[model samples]
Target: MYYIVMNMNCEDCGRYIPHSVYKYIGFCEEQGKVVFNEPPTNCDTVSKTTMDSLSSVFGSLGWVYCIDCKAPIFEMEEAVKHIASHHLITTRFMYDSVAAEEVGAVS
Candidate 1:
């Protein structure tokens, strides 16, 4: 589980992380530094792409996080199923938001 902290002190950070998320949320631990103020999105981490970037990522085994529940999606065959079952997820569309920021239409 992750935390959506909303307080000055990390130890004193308060607020619970919501289960359902539809939009992007920004969280930072740095006091006032610009770089630290805004955490990097998925795109920032994948700035450089290798020959097997997509292959390695898709081949890796793990539960893809859901946009709503961030749930453990096993076979989110249908988006509608996500509401009923929090275990369905589509790995390809997982990084849709940052797709445009990547090259070769691979993310």
Candidate 2:
């Protein structure tokens, strides 16, 4: 199963962003599905066109990190499990606050 660490805050760095950090396991399969942070609503069909347009812009954008301590997590699943067992994080979000600063460079 793929894991997505969403709405996580980094304790060490205190970088809190909403719906930015994402992690995916089992992404190599051709038939795999991309799970969003929130579930799709009934209005998805009506918003399909807008979503498609946004996809081209944001499809290649993603961030990954530890849910706790905000350390750079290289081995995702195992590291996350370890952190969860030992550390207590009060918040969760997608992007690390440090990473959020770099967004200006993308343009």
Candidate 3:
């Protein structure tokens, strides 16, 4: 687990951002790109799906931004959590509770 102090300033506020490199996906030298490992068995289904969707959207070069300020947040999962925690705002998932309810109804 490595913590990286980002030298870049926030685009919205110009504040320095610090992030945990290990909290999000990481690059593998042998693989030549960032890779998402398998989620832990304890992980919730929604979170796993969120990560998969984010990876697909951003691929290896995606940047997660703060929902409120549009500043560069950490990576996908961490950014979502950060928004909920720090900003008290929910990060909207495409497969959100409404979708879950619809699926539940169909089943």
lDDT of 1 by residue, 1-107 (tens): 22122322211121211122432332222222112212233222212222243234435753344555655544423433542343222332212356456548556
Question: Could you arrange the candidates by TM-score from highest to lowest?
Answer: 3, 1, 2
RMSD of each: 16.4, 14.1, 14.6
Q: Rank the candidates by lDDT, best first.
A: 3, 2, 1
TM-score, model 2 to reference:
0.22
lDDT of all the models against the reference?
0.31, 0.33, 0.34
Clashing pairs in 2: 7-92, 7-93, 8-92, 8-93, 9-91, 9-92, 15-97, 20-94, 21-94, 21-95
TM-score of each: 0.24, 0.22, 0.26
Instruction: Write one digit per residue (lDDT tens) for candidate 2, span 1-107.
Output: 22233343222222222233343211111223333323223212211112233233233432234434555444434444644464322123443447756677555
Error of 2 at 1 (Å): 3.1
lDDT of 3 by residue, 21-69 (tens): 2222333233344334323233222122233545554565466555345
The number of clashing residue pairs in model 3 is 0
- Report the CA-based lDDT of candidate 3 relative to the real structure: 0.34
